[model samples]
Every structure is written in C-alpha cells, then in structure tokens.
Target chain A: MRTILILKRLITVFYYLIFIGLIAQLFRIINQIITGKIHDLKPKIFGEQLDYGTMSLFEIGLSGVVPVVLFYCFFQSLIYLKRSLKDLESGNYFSALVITNFKKIGILFLVCSLGEVIGKLLFFIVFKSKFHFELDSSVVLFFIMGLFFMFLSEVFQKARRLQQENELTI
Target chain B: MLAKREMKSKELAEIIGITTANLSILKSGKAKAVRFSTLEAICKALDCQPSDILEYKED
Candidate 1:
C-alpha cells in the first residue's frame, strides 16, 4: 500500500514534469520561428547546412506540425497511464474505464512510434538530407509497456468476472 | 424455519460450507439462482425437504 502511494506520487510528479517540458518545448519552437533562429540553426542536408528560406511553406508547416502532434500523443498516453494507475491505487483494478484507458495508451504509443519514423522519413525527403533512421529504445519500451498494460487489463477483466461468479455462487 | 428449528445462522453456514454473507444473500431473495449442489447442502443442513424451503411465484 505504501509502495503504491509512493509510486502514484512519483508518477504524478513525472506527469507534471512532462507537461512542463512539453510547454517549454512549444515556447522554444515558437520563439525560434518568430525570431528566425530556426533558419540560423544550420540543419544539415547532404553534409551541408540547408537554408530554411529555400524550403517550401508546406515543408516548414509539416515540420512544425509533426513535432507538436507527436508530443500531444505522447503526453496524452502518459495521462491515460497515470489515470489507470490512480484507478489501481483506489482499488478499482477491474474497472472497465481502466481497461479502456490502457487500450488507448497502447494505441497512442504505437501511433507515436510509427509517426516518429514516418515523420523523420518525410523530413529527410523534403530536406534532401542524409537519410538517418535508428530504432529508438524509449519508443520501443513505451510500445511494449503499453502492450503489457493492455494484457493486464484483459487479465483484470477475467479476474473481475471470476469475482462476480464467486459472489453469485451461493 | 431456522428460528422455528432453533438453529443459528452461523452454525448453519458453517455446516453448509458457506459464508454468512452468502446466507444473507439467499435469505434476502437477491440470489439470481441456486445450484443443485448448494440446494442439496442447504437441505441436508436444515433437515428439510426442498419443497418445504422453496416456493415459486409469478413475477
């Protein structure tokens, strides 16, 4: 019980941190765009700095939109996970809401991972840059953890059914 | 019947291998259905006929 409380508190803290970090990143990106710092940052393409002015409006729009969408999805997934943990802490492990949230988190993680890969590919093509792709461990971990929670939700569903049967047995 | 037979609910529950809560569920008529095995156990513990303890009424 104490461990659960501590974990809940820790997750809450992490949730706040992630929220703040996302906001900070958003501000930073906005500042960069407004101040024309993005153009000066020297984003490399084919071993040379690509001038942002040369990029089309569509490419720039996509670059900005993709990061924001990825962050939103990742943050929302964490929010769902935190809520599920809160349900568990309250001894509502077998709740349908928890299961739904878990499934949502799983799907969001999968989407984030796939979106990251596709977004990078699009960026590479648009910039005519060195094609760089690497399997990110954190994204993989999140995806696996999401799947595990989804599996746990199913187990909880079965356990809840058995509990009901036991209650009705006599 | 239990009152007339001077039997305690606790003792009956112990003999029938069920909890007092389950016994209460039965007494309250909240149970959806009763299994034959449980009905048999209850009948044996109470020393009564199934008919003596059960009745049907139209909803």
Candidate 2:
C-alpha cells in the first residue's frame, strides 16, 4: 500500500510533466511562428518535414490532428492508471473500477503506440518509399505492457468472481 | 425444524452466533456452501439431524 501511494504520487508528477511538456511545445511553435522563425521549428513537428512557408495555417493545423489524438490517448491512459493505482491503494483488489481502468489503459497504450507505426506508414506512402516495417524497441515494450494489462484485467475478473462465490458461501 | 422447536430465525441466528442476514440466506437456499460447524450448530439447536433439513437436488 505504501508503495502504491508512492507510485501514485510519482504518476501524478509525471502527469503534470507531460501536460507541461505539451504546453511548452505548443508555446515554442507559436513563438517561432510569431517571430517568423518557423524554419527554426523542429523538422518533425508533425511526424513529417513540414514546409512552413509553403503551407497554409489550415494545412499545418491538419497535420497536428494525429499528434493531438496520440496525446489524448496517452493522457487518458495515464488518468486511468492513476485511478487504478488509487483503487489499489484503497484495497480494492478485484473491484470493477480497477479492472475497467486497466482495460482502458491497455487499449489506450496500444492505440497511442500504434500511432507511431501509422505515422511511419504515412511517411512511406506519401514519399513512395520502400515498405520497411521497422519496430522500435520502446514501441514493442509499450505494446507488450498493454497486452499485460489486458491480461491482468481478465485475471482480476476471474478473481472477482471467486471472491463473490467465497463471500456467498457460509 | 425452526417451527417444531418454536424458534424464530432471529433466535436461531443468535443462538448459532451468526447474522440474521446469513440465516436468511441459509433459509432461502441462496448460500453456496455451509461450514460444518455452522451446520452442526444448526442441527444441535433444532434437535434434528442434517438429513432432516438438508436436501440434495440435481442442477
């Protein structure tokens, strides 16, 4: 329980960090745009080499949609993780909330991680390059972690059923 | 057995050191399983054999 509390605090800090990082990134892009230094912005701002001077605001905005969706999925997963940790700290081992949160976290992890692959595929398709599906180690790790959490949700479901049976037995 | 012994469900629960809710569960056949100690206590309190109160049915 104490470890869970510590982890909860850590996740809370990480959550804030991710939020701040996104804000900083947004501010940096806006600052660069305002200063007419759009060329100085990161090359892969939208998972591609965006030609700022040649592209309209709407085109740039459209490019941001994928990143926004990935960020949302990651953020929602973190929220569910925090909730699951809170439930565990409260001694809700096999509760429905924990199970659902774990499942949601798993799904979000998969979805957000898959965004990278989709971005790579778009790069290949747009450039008419060779089809090289190179899997990054971190992406594979996240994918496995997602699957593990999904397995954990099923385990908890079974445990909850057993707990109910035990409780009903006199 | 409770009626023959002129005892209420609440009285039986109290005598057997269990909650009335649990006693109600036992009576309604909603309980998954009964402990031997609880069954023995019930039988002793009602002055009856386990066979007198327990029935087996195929599901």
Which structure among the candidates has the greatest TM-score? 2
* Candidate 2 local Cα displacement, residue A88, angstroms: 0.9
Clashes of each: 0, 0
How big is the positional error of residue A119 in model 1, measured in Å on the Cα after superposition? 2.3
DockQ of 2: 0.80
Give the number of the best model, judged by DockQ: 2
* Tens-place lDDT digits, model 2, residues A1-170: 67888899999999999989989988998899898887555456433566756666675665667778888998999989987887798898899999999899888888877886786666555443557465888678879988999999999999999998888787
Per-residue CA lDDT of model 1 for B1-59, tens digit only, reads 78878999999889989899999988888787788988999899888988988888787
> If candidate 1 were superposed on the true structure by all CA atoms, what would the RMSD be?
4.9
Docking quality level of the chain pair in candidate 1: acceptable
Q: In model 1, which regions exceed 4 Å deviation?
A: A29-54, A129-132, B1-41, B44-46, B49-59
TM-score for chain A as predicted in candidate 2? 0.83
- Compute the interface RMSD for candidate 2: 0.7
The recovered share of true contacts, given per candidate in order, is 0.53, 0.84
Q: Candidate 2, clashing residue pairs? A: none
Q: What would the per-residue lDDT of candidate 2 be over residues B1-59, giving only the tens digit for each residue?
A: 88888999999999999999999999899998899999999998999999999998888
Each prediction's RMSD over C-alphas, in Å, is 4.9, 2.9
TM-score of each: 0.70, 0.84
